[model samples]
Target chain A: MTSSAAATIALTDVAARRGNTTIWDQGSFDIPQPSITAVIGPNGSGKSTLLHLLLGLLEPYSGTVEVFGSEPREASEQLGFVPQSYHVPGSDYLTVLEYVRLGKIGNQFFWRSPKGMDQQVADAIEAVGLAGYERRRLRHLSGGEQQRAAIAQSLMNQPKTLLMDEPFASLDVRHQQRLAELIHGLRMDHSIGSLVVVHDLNPILPYLDGVIYLLDGHAHYAPTSEAVDEDLLTHLYGCPVQVTRTAQGDIFTRVTGHAP
Target chain B: MIELPTVTVQENWLEILTADFMRQAFIGGIITAVAAGAIGYFVILRQQAFASHALAHIGFPGATAAILLGIPITLGMVTFTVVGAIAMALTGNRLNDRDIATGTILAFATGLGLLFSNIASTAAANVQNVLFGNLLATTTSQLISFAVFLFLICLTIAICYRPLLFTSISPEVARARGLHTGRLNLIFLVTLALTITMAVQVVGVLLVFALIVTPPATALLLTARSLPALFLSIGIGTFAVIGGLVLSALFNLPPTFFIVSITTLLWVIATITRPQNA
Candidate 1:
């Protein structure tokens, strides 16, 4: 692993509020280059807001955020985002290939179709395991396939950093594994930095290099091993949380009073 | 059975079309139809049909006020729709729920139109033209304006095609990729306002909504590709305009009535026979 000084994204004493409610205060974190970091938080804990701040969609009321040594807005092309619900509404005519092609639209020339864009789009689709489904309409795809297509679309920009919000929320276990594999492959092959917001950390814990926990409008950056500890999680969630290790040496979380 | 309107016996379709006004109306209507058809595709794609409708009604008072002030109705309609578009865009940006802003703008516009039409009794003579259209009374200058505006719209679409499509599909993703979605939306609303002005001169305020929605809706039902649907919409709109002009001339009825009827009929047919990916 590279040193902390080689961080691709750095936030210094950032604070953000939306409509009279403070989402985050004095939040600070560093996302290293070419690493997968899970942003774990309960609902309304500003996990998505962190992504928004990094994407320049929302500004921090105080402090600074830098991506690739520049402002978030200036480094947008180097950053790709896969939103929680990438199924764009009211577009029945949009095909998978066309949807993926939209990613390249931001950086390419607008007046004419760029040379080699078709090959690039095809490569992206293939990278996400959606090769045969290029011409299919987006609405026809399964939830998992749609998510893959969204990932392929994000990959069209060839971003160095990818930010995803609740990507595994709607997928089944099988699809979640498939998406994790794809994300792991991206991190390994391209050294693409990733920050994924997850409600349940067990699904992606195997591929995550580090974790950032948000609680009570504060950020807690921890190593992967320390992040999954029972005492740390119990303190983070304000509940008695259990971390169980299975026979295969895999870890999972269970709330003390909740049924499996 | 419905009572049939008495038809004026004309020498021939060719003979009726030879009049300078008929020729002008035909050409001008075609121009408006082409522009509306192209613009309508994005309107439906982005789900801005209701906003477009509100913009048309908002232009009503502008046309009436122009008549009372002895100015061109086109200028008045353009000015009012632009103002309404800006107001609605700003409100939509702030509220996040565009329906509330659009509804509020529509109601306020309708109220202003009612007040203006009632204030100047002399302008009431032209109110019917504003509400129902005056295609037969279209002047050469209006046709020129239509052509110029159509060129500008086509140019704008051509230049901003990719970015516009990206923003329309998923604004958040596009914004993350550095496309200014708010500015794009504002530009789209203003362009919609211009389109409303053009179609208003041909189909009037009430029926212009049909021209701006029905053809694209029908095309969307028929095709599965955006470009193909766009071309299909243009074809349908142009055909309806020409057919409506001919039938209105044959029946000696108001052209706006026939145009709206024909466009609605096209939509019904397209819906019933829509392809199920066959």
Candidate 2:
């Protein structure tokens, strides 16, 4: 099947399995370039599996998954990923400068820090608003700062697209808003589009241009306004879900019922 | 109650330094310390302390078998440890599975060492030396082997520093970035095996942690920067070896005993004085 030429990510009838269990199958979606898209789904709806597929960490059972007009693995250099957990092993001893410098590493024989690597690391840190945190240990940073440092590490490659897995999982609302602004700023200044996997979509609803919601073993994508319908969300969640707008024109979603 | 050995410093310092055996012990101990210090950082970073301990025991049979065959003990130790490392690495990245594999292999290797030692009854002392180390018995040929192994380890680490650090911390991200994480894991385990083989010569199989884990573990308590921590680990390892040698000469005790004691004391001190939130 031919994918849209302009789409940054295109999945055609993609299916994924974990062990003997089929997580999701018959999934198809397209995420355009220069857009902030949220990948939202209920727990175990294969939200992370979708990110893994795009990052070329998993194989589709019987479908084509493309990123930037090529197989996901072939376009890995053009993509950056922020994993769900920031608790990396041995990160306790890594300074911000050292950890951020890791992003410059690729599949290379010898590791010679490129000329101006320090400046580039500094720039990435500054871009994340972590300007004076170069010498701070990752374990010493607050949750929001750690998330920003992870973002800075991802940006070291100057990736055209970023894939973040649950970037707001443990953050307070204020930090979440700040992260939303950072994502928006990345898109505006660096033209780096983001496909963020999130459980609660309200925190990022203001900046999100589109969403890819996984449900009933399929993925569907739509613009934010088109996807925010109460019935659609209620059906997707298999519970009573209410999508409401605040007085300041902000979108909020609340699950009005307990687990079925 | 066991009686302690008489504390005596009869040998002149200059004369002790000039002795061939003393020189060999110092050289061998220093080389082993350097390799252990460098690799122990990663060992701790990767949380593979158990595997590291297992690798040393896995080499025990090899050393005993080499004694039975009248071959170089280091060669046999390297062969067994590297093979064991490959087997453990093949078990994939799950710590639980890897530990099970390492423990299983360790059990079998210990059984084999017992068999080899039984067959080479006349060389029981040699087997004892392998278990607890006899650094003074390190031959010139074995010293050469230690130097060569140290060079290879340093070279490989230098060439693969960034990726090694990257994979050690966040393997999923490294794999996503197109790094061959499996191959890197294989390389790291092999290097770790080599370091274990060398460390076994100084502290022997049972006390390998003295050089391989304790120093780095202590260094980690004091600092949160990679380079500084690594250097501090090396310094601690070096000090333990030299101090152990000197104390052994003064007290007429086993160098391994002093080495382990010094490292354990340092680790205790570091733990007590460890910085908060570091």
Top of the candidates by DockQ: 2
lDDT of 1 by residue, B1-278 (tens): 99997677455767777789999998889988888998899888787888888899889889888887888889899999999888777767643478877777678777888788888787775898888888898998888888888897888777777777787777779878777777777788888898899888788888887789999988878876778888889898899888888887877777888888989998988888976651
TM per prediction: 0.92, 0.93
Worst 10 residues of 2 chain B by lDDT: B9-18
DockQ of all predictions against the true structure, Cα-based: 0.55, 0.59
Model 2: reference contacts kept, as a fraction: 0.63
Give candidate 1's whole-model lDDT.
0.83
For model 1, the DockQ equals 0.55
In CAPRI terms, model 1 is classed as: medium
Cα-lDDT of candidate 2:
0.87
- The sequence of per-residue lDDT tens digits that candidate 2 reaches over residues A1-260 is 34446457888998888887888887777778878999988899999999899988898887999898989888888898999875676776788888888888634558666788788999999999999889888888988998888889889888888999999898998998899999999999999999999888898888889999887888888999988888888888788889889898878899999758
Clashing residue pairs, backbone N/CA/C < 3 A, model 2: none
- Chain A (candidate 2) TM-score to true chain A: 0.93
For each candidate, report what fraction of the true interface contacts it reproduces: 0.53, 0.63
Tens digit of lDDT per residue, candidate 2, span B229-257?
Answer: 88899999999999988887776778999
Q: Summarize candidate 1's per-residue lDDT along A1-260 as a digit string, tens digits.
A: 34446457888899878888988788777767788899987789899999999899899889999987779888887888999978876544678888898788743435677789999999999989999988788778888888888888898878988999999898889888888888899989877878999988878888878888887778778879889988878877777799998899787887886422
lDDT of each: 0.83, 0.87
Q: Candidate 2: which docking quality band?
A: medium
